[model samples]
Target: MTKTVRIALQGLTCDGCVSSLTTAFMTNPAVESVTVTREPSQATVTYNSAETTPEALCSLVDDAGFEGTVSES
Candidate 1:
């Protein structure tokens, strides 16, 4: 199954920030797409549930040097 998760990213202040965020998600084999907004500091990630979970996705962002957290909203 596929799932879409929205996460909040803190400390993004430039376009290059988006580049790293994009790279973080794309590195995961199960991630289908990643869309992040700077003003709102949010990312909508579509991924395969069987291969990856929302928590895992958030970890990716943190690993890439960003402060991130998954939210119900």
Candidate 2:
């Protein structure tokens, strides 16, 4: 099933950060879409739940050098 993951991001300094993250998330085959906002420091990722988990998405953000938490939309 497809699920949307609302992520609260921290330490997003610039547009570069957003772009970088967008690219990183897009690389995941299971991810259907991603929307990131800098002012609010949050991201919405739509993906196939059967292929990926919320924790994995959060870890992806963390591994990219940003802090993130997953929440329900």
All candidates: TM-score? 0.94, 0.94
Estimate the lDDT of model 2. 0.92
* Cα lDDT computed for each candidate against the true fold: 0.90, 0.92
In the range 10-56, model 1's lDDT, one tens digit per residue, is 97999999988998889999999999889788899999999989999
Residue-by-residue lDDT tens digits, candidate 2, 1-73: 9989899999899999999999988988999999998988999999999999989999999999999998667
Candidate 2 segments whose C-alpha is farther than 4 A from its true place: none
The TM-score measured for candidate 1 stands at 0.94
Best-performing candidate as measured by lDDT: 2
Question: Candidate 1: deviation at residue 17, Å?
Answer: 0.4
- Stretch of 10 with least lDDT, candidate 2: 64-73
**CA error at residue 29 for candidate 2, angstroms:** 0.8
| True lDDT of residue 62, candidate 2 | 92
The local lDDT score (0 to 100) that residue 65 gets in candidate 1 is 89
Q: What's the residue-level lDDT of 53 in candidate 2?
A: 95
